[model samples]
Target: MSSRSLPRLPAAPGTIETGSTLKTLLDREAIDCLAHNLARVHRTLNAKAFRREAREGIEPLAILARGQHLAKVLRRHLPARYEQAVAVLVRSLTPSLSETEGNGLAGFFYLPHVSFVATYGLDPAKNGGRDPFEASMRAQYEITRRFSAEFSIRPFLIKWPERTLARLREWTRDPDPHVRRLCSEGSRPRLPWAMRIPAFVQDPRPVLPILEALKDDSELYVRRSVANHVGDIAKDHPALAFELCERWAEGADENRKWLIRHAVRHPAKKGVKAALRLRKLAAAG
Candidate 1:
C-alpha cells in the first residue's frame, strides 16, 4: 500500500506536524521512503523484499520499535559486511541540516538509520568486517548531522567506554555543533528515554571533561546539551556538578552563565541552597 493508505497519516496530511505522535513519523511512507533511498544509494539492494519486510506488521510498532524493525530489515537487505552497509547508509543521507532548529520531524526520517548503527554496528567481526567500531563512529558523525545518533552512540560508550570517550573528546572540537552536542548528550547518565550509562551515574567524573569542553560552546544547541549534562550529573553527584560549575563561573561569559543557571535549574527548584545561589549569580547572564 502507498503512504496515503496509512490510517494515521491523514491527521497530519502525509506529514508529522507538531502534535502528531512520534510513531506516526515512521508510517508506511517513511518505510517506503527509506527503502527507496537505500536502493537509490546502493543499486544492489533487494528493495522489493526490504520494503515488504519493513511493512509487514509494522503498523502496531511504536517509533523506536519501528526504527529497530527497519534496521533489522536493512541488515538483511544491505551488504553483509558492516562497513559497506554503513557506507551506503551514510551516502543515502540527504544532507546535513542547515540550521540548528525548526527542521521538524523531517529529520526523524533517519531514525531507522540511527537504529541500524546501534542495533548492528557495534562489533566488527560479528557483522562480517574489521574496523566496525570506527566505521560506526564515522557513520554516526554523518548521521548525527542529519538526525542525531545520540541514541546510537550509547551502546558504543557502554561496550567500549575508554575508546568511545576518547573519540568523543576529539569530537568536542568538531566544527558541527551537532557532533559536539552528541559528545555530551550521548553520554548523559540519566538521559531520558535512552539507556542509562550506569558508569556515569555511579561516578560522573569521567564525563565531566566533556561537559567542561562544551560549557561555553558558541551554539546554544550545544550549550543546552552541556547544561542538561550538568543537570544529570547534579542528580547523582551534586557536589561534583557544583565544583565544575563554580570553576566554570570564574571566566564565564553571558552564554556560559546562562548554561550554568539552566544546569542548576532543577536543583534550584527544589530550594537547594547551593543551586539557588548559582541561579542568582547567573540569573542575569
Candidate 2:
C-alpha cells in the first residue's frame, strides 16, 4: 500500500512522543541507525534506497506497520535474492552473544534489527530462495539469543511444523532464556497481534511437549512465555489447559505456581468451569 493510503496509527500506551507517537520501541532514529549500520557492514547496501525508504511516509505507520514497510523496502533494494540479503543483515548484527547478558538501552538497541528480521527475513518465497529454511532457522536461533526471534520463528512453525517443533523441543534446554522463551512464545496459537497458527488452535498437541519441558523453567521470562502459551490454548480448549495446569500443579515449585496462576488468569476471568476449579485448587493450596 502507498504511504499516503496507509492509515495513521495511534500512539501506543507508554509511548512518549517526540515527533510522532513512539508506541513501538522502534522509532525513526532507530531505523536510521539500522540503515547506517547495514551500509557500514555491507558497502554495497543501497544507502540511498535504504534512507529514502526509511523516511518516506514513516510518520503515519505504527511500530509494527513501520517494520513491515521497512521489510518491503529491504526486499526491493537489498540483493535480489533472500539468502544473500539475510546473510548480510545477519552478519551486520553486533557479535553474537555467548550467554544472554546486557540490559538497559544496551539490550534495547537491537529492537529494530530484530523487528526487521521477524517481519521480512523469515519468509522463503518472499526471499526467492529454493531452500532457505535451514538458513532462516539458524538466523533465528542466533538472533533470538541476542534479542528475540519469537514472532520471526512463527512462519517456520507454520511452514514446517514438525521440524520446527523438534528444534523447539531441543531449544527448551538452551541456556539462553531468550531462546527458551521463543520455544514457547513462537508456537503460541494466539500470540497477540501476530497471525494465528490454525493447526495449533485446532489441536495444540504438537506444542504440548515444548510447554511440558518449560513448565518449571528457571527464568521468569521463559516461564511467562509458557504461561501465555498455555493461556492461549486455554482460550480455545479450557479442558486441555486445565488438565495441563493440574498436571503441572502436582508438586509444583514456586515458579510453576506463578505460571499456573498466570495461565488461568484469563480463563478464570471468563469463568470457565475448569479454570474456576483450578483457581479454587490454587487458592486452597
Candidate 3:
C-alpha cells in the first residue's frame, strides 16, 4: 500500500457548463419561483409580501448580497424567532430528493437554499442552543448536500470548536459523501470565498483528527475537500502539513496518495523543501 506501489487514482471530472451564475441563479424570476413553491407548503406565507420585499431593494445586489436581502425579507415576513423562521422555510421546502423534480430544492435552486441558512439560520441556530442547533444543522445539511454549507458551518466551528469538531468527526463516517465532505470542507482554515477560521489558521491541531478520518474517503468529492483542508493548513503551518503529507504518503493507497499530492501542492508551489520532497517521493514512487 505504499505510495509508489499504489495504483493511480481516477482523474476528477471536468467542469460542466450549467448555464447559471450567482446573479442569474438568484434573480427575480427565481425568487418568484421560490415564492410559488413556498406558498404551496405554507398557506399563510404572504407570497406577495415576500416577493415585493425581495424585488424592491434587490435590483443591483450580487448573489450573496441577494441572499442577504432575501434573508432580511424572510425575517420581516416569516416567523420572528430564528428557529421558527428556519422551521417555516423547512416545512415549506419539498421534503425529499425524489420530489425535487429536477428543479425543486435539490437541483439548480440548491445554492439559494444554502444562502437562506447562511443569511438567517446560522446566528439563530447558534444562539438557540448548542445541541439543538447542531441537530438542526445536521438536518439542514441534507439539503446542503445539493449545495454546500461549507461557508455557513465555519462560524459554528469557530464558536464551539470542541463540540463542532466532535460532531465533524462523527460526520466523517456519515453515509453521504457530501456530509463526509462537509466534515473536511467546513473546517478549512483558509477556505476560499468564505470567512477564515482564525483559530484553525493559528493552530490546526483541532481539525487534524477529522481530516485523518477522511483522508482515505471513498468519494473523490470528500477526498478533494480533505486535500484542500490540508493545503489550507500548509499556508500557515508548512512543517506540519509536510509532516502529515509524509506520514499519510507511507503505506497509502491510490486515494490517500492523491490526498497527499493535493495537500502538498500549495507548499510545493512555494518551493518549500519538505513539501517538494513529498511530491518528489510521490512522483518517484
Candidate 4:
C-alpha cells in the first residue's frame, strides 16, 4: 500500500475548511498519487502537508511534515515551506528519470506543493532544498494567471520585505529565465494566490529599477513578467506606468512586445501609443 493511497497522519485537530476548499480545486488522483509517492519514500508526512496546503483550510502540513527530520536531510530550505522537500525529491527523482532531468516531473509535483502553501497561506516551516529563493520563484510560476491576477505581495512584504525585494532585484539578473521572471512576477500587485502587495501598488517606484533591468531581457518569460509588473503599476498610476512603457518602447524586442501586451491587459490609450511607437521602430529597423 503506497503511503499516497493511505490517509494523512492523525488528521489535524479541526474540520479544516481549507481542506474542503482544496478538494474543490485539486484533483483527488493527483493528491493521492503524490501522497502515495511520498509514502513509498517514507515521506507520507511531507505529502500530507503538501495536500493540506494545496486546498483552502487544512492544517499546516509543513509544520507537521517537519517532524520527519526534514531539516537534517537537505542542504538548503526555502522559507515558504515544503519547497525544500520538493527540491529534495526532485534531486532524488532526477537520476532515475530520462534526459530531461525530471524538470517536467519536478514542475508537475511542484504545483501541488505550491498550491498548498501560497494559496492556503499556511506556513511550512523551513526545511531543506538547493535554494530557498529559487523554490519560491518556481512556485509562483506554477500557479495560473488567475492567481497572478489576484496575488498580493503584502504578506510577503510585511513578513520579509527586505528579503523578498532583495531576492527580486537579485533574481532580475539570474541566469535562469524562470528565476528572472520571478523577479517581476512575484512582486505584481495582483499576483494571484499571493498576498496583496498594496505598498508596491501605492509606490511602485521601488521596483522600477528591477523592471528596467529586465525590460530587454533575452528570456521571453522574464521580459513578459517585467511588462506585467509595469502594467500592474499602470492600473494604479497610469501616468507613471505610461512613462515607463514609453521608455520600454524605445528599442524593444519581440519578447518586449509580448510583455507589453500582457502588461497592458487592462489596456489604455497610452498602451496603444506605446505599441504603435514600438511597431514603427521595428519597421524602421
In model 3, state the lDDT of residue 280.
71
Models 1 onward score TM values of 0.92, 0.82, 0.82, 0.57
Candidate 1 positional error at 107, Å: 1.3
Q: Note the Cα lDDT for every prediction shown.
A: 0.85, 0.74, 0.70, 0.51
| Residue 278 lDDT, candidate 2, scale 0-100 | 74
How far is 266's C-alpha from truth in model 3 (Å)? 2.4
Rate residue 88 of model 4 by lDDT.
35
Candidate 2 local lDDT, 1-285, one digit each (tens): 454332222223333457745334556556666676677657887777777877788777776677676777766666767777777767666655555433423333354445656665556676774677766777788777766777678777887889889999998998778889889988999999788999999999989999999888887878888999999998899888889899888887677887888899987888777887776666534
Give, for candidate 4, the lowest lDDT window spanning 10 residues.
93-102
What does the lDDT come to for candidate 1?
0.85
Clashing pairs in 3: none
Candidate 1 per-residue lDDT, tens place, 1-285, comes to 554422221122335556667888788788777776776668888878888898898888888888888888888888888888889988877768788877667777788889999988887785665768888999999999987888999999899999999999999999998899999999999998889999989998888888878887889999999999999999989999988888888877899889999999999999999999888777673
Number of clashing residue pairs in every model? 0, 0, 0, 23
Indicate the worst ten consecutive residues by lDDT in candidate 1: 5-14
**Sort by lDDT, top down from the best:** 1, 2, 3, 4
After superposition, candidate 3 runs with Cα above 4 Å error = 1-21, 94-112, 119-132
